[model samples]
Target chain A: DAGITQSPRYKITETGRQVTLMCHQTWSHSYMFWYRQDLGHGLRLIYYSAAADITDKGEVPDGYVVSRSKTENFPLTLESATRSQTSVYFCASFNRESYNSPLHFGNGTRLTVT
Target chain B: QKEVEQDPGPLSVPEGAIVSLNCTYSNSAFQYFMWYRQYSRKGPELLMYTYSSGNKEDGRFTAQVDKSSKYISLFIRDSQPSDSATYLCAMRDSFANAGGTSYGKLTFGQGTILTVHP
Candidate 1:
């Protein structure tokens, strides 16, 4: 029961609507990341947080906002959803204490914007 | 060119056959390499990892990295039906002090899907 979890495993939103995907982990990992997976692109990082209140943009962060008020939670918000935003989103965490620590990922949330 | 490139393959193989998966990267700074296995509708799990250019074997799985050619490979011996899943290759630079923080960010390749039939 101490794994990562994402709410509303599936989501559908109309174009221009605002949507927020929630991610929570019980491991208290210091590094949390958000990535979007599409057909041709494997997994592109949208945003990542090194710790609570410390966030950075990733490869593709446009139109997306992320916040980490607490160490166990990192949520991603789409200000104005577009059809291009329709893809599977994954939340991952890694312990920074070890150099070789592997990233642990949540089940993922499938979002569709029409 | 992308930082990492992999063939998005829906490769099929009979059980007990050997399977090979590979990826190429354009970044020469990447020193840590890894492979992850992802099942349908599930998140990827780390399968193997190697630091620098070398080969590491674990049971039926083997991971090889060639920094000279900027290529990496994963070999599966005696593949089974359970091996039917997507394999992802990921790499990251060893420099962790760019901004005084641990730069553990990873660049991932497009996963390769493999199906081993019984």
Candidate 2:
């Protein structure tokens, strides 16, 4: 009962539509991250939050946006979803205060933007 | 070049065989290393973790970090069919030495897909 969870385990949206993916973690970790995985590119970071109000871009943050208004929730929003954004999105969490902690991830959301 | 590079291997091996996977990084600032195993349509699971330049063995898996050469490796002995999945290598810096910038942020390599056949 104490793990990360993502809503709408599967989703499909039309191109240019606004879509938001939700991530909730019961562990109360201070650090949260979003990553996208494609056919051959593996997992690429989209955005990360160091705390409730501190967020930073990862390697592939151009098409994605994230906000952390609360510690338990970190949501990823695509202002205008495109077909290129149709991929699996994973949410992960870590404890910044714990030195060198491994990330705990959610089951992930399969978003297919047509 | 990617900061961390790993071969996108669809490495196939017979069950009970030993498996070796590796990744190399360009940033020597990395001091912590980790290996994650992910099955199809699932999130990655932390398999092994190592800090500093040495080898740490847990069960049938061994993780080795060679900071001197910026290389990291994972080995699975007597592999099982259930071990088929993607193995990703990730690294982060020791926060105390990151000039207050790094906060357990991980840089990951392109994962290698491994298939253990019966």
Candidate 1 regions with alpha-carbon error over 4 angstroms: B97-102
What TM-scores does chain A show, candidate by candidate in order? 0.99, 0.96
Task: Estimate, for each residue in B3-118, the C-alpha lDDT of model 1 and write its tens digit.
Answer: 89999988999999999999999988889999999999999999999999999999999999999999999999999999999999999988553344547789999999999999
DockQ, per model, reads: 0.75, 0.70
Please give the TM-score that candidate 2 achieves against the real structure: 0.96
Candidate 1 local lDDT, residue B49: 95
Q: CA lDDT of each candidate? A: 0.94, 0.91
**DockQ category of candidate 2:** medium
Q: Summarize candidate 1's per-residue lDDT along A25-47 as a digit string, tens digits.
A: 99999999999988789999999
lDDT of 1: 0.94
Chain B TM-scores, listed for every candidate in order, come to 0.95, 0.95
